[model samples]
Target: MGLLDGILGQVAGNPEIANLAERIGLSPEQVTAAIAALGAAHTQPGDTVAGAADSTGLSPDVLQQILTHLGGEGALGRLGALLGGAEGADGSGGLGSMLGGLFGKA
Candidate 1:
């Protein structure tokens, strides 16, 4: 799995895809595919969950639930950090502002 996929897997509150899948009523493979789609969508220019739903054929609500389970904006911050916009020494930088805009948290 790639970094984003690994982070998604971890952020869903479990590293075991099967466990999260079972809870969400999807197979592990489905969950994995959805996670991958979510990661891809995150890099695109719009609503991440909605975009993932469009590509993955899952509903936005389901994707949002998964996102919420994965720590929501907090997870986005971590993802941004991993992507290299490390909030800087003063904790103000690309990641924070960019993620804030992404989630309307600004």
Candidate 2:
């Protein structure tokens, strides 16, 4: 699917994400902008979640909400826990999954 389509899908599937944006006072266009910004990024292989937040137009808090809703409470949490379950890996972190620095200087 195209980028825009994928984004709409993300928001549609997750009401929390939609509510978070609404509560944050983000306009539909701003939400679109945020998602588009994220989509255009290409995070490095070792980049931390914070680092990706900096590159995207959206803030870390906003990003967290998006991520939380993207995979739903159950899936991403389980995914995060499963990934964090590895020995020596620090717990209490986000999903190890990377979506690339989609908003690469665009």
Stretches off by above 4 angstroms in model 1 are 1-15, 80-106
Q: What is the lDDT of residue 91 in candidate 1?
A: 56
Best by lDDT: 1
For all predicted structures, in order, the TM-scores are 0.57, 0.38
Q: In model 2, which runs have C-alpha deviations exceeding 4 angstroms?
A: 1-20, 48-52, 72-106
Judged by TM-score, which candidate is best?
1
lDDT of model 2 at position 1 = 35
Instruction: Return the clash pairs for model 1, or none.
Output: none
Cα displacement (angstroms), candidate 1, residue 58, comes to 0.9
The residue-by-residue lDDT of candidate 1 on 12-77, one tens digit each, is: 453355666787888767776776677668778998988899999988887786677556745655
List model 2 lDDT by residue over 1-106, tens digit each: 3534544454434444456568777765555445444433322344333554776656777765555444433343333333334324563222222121111111
The local distance difference test score of each candidate is 0.63, 0.44
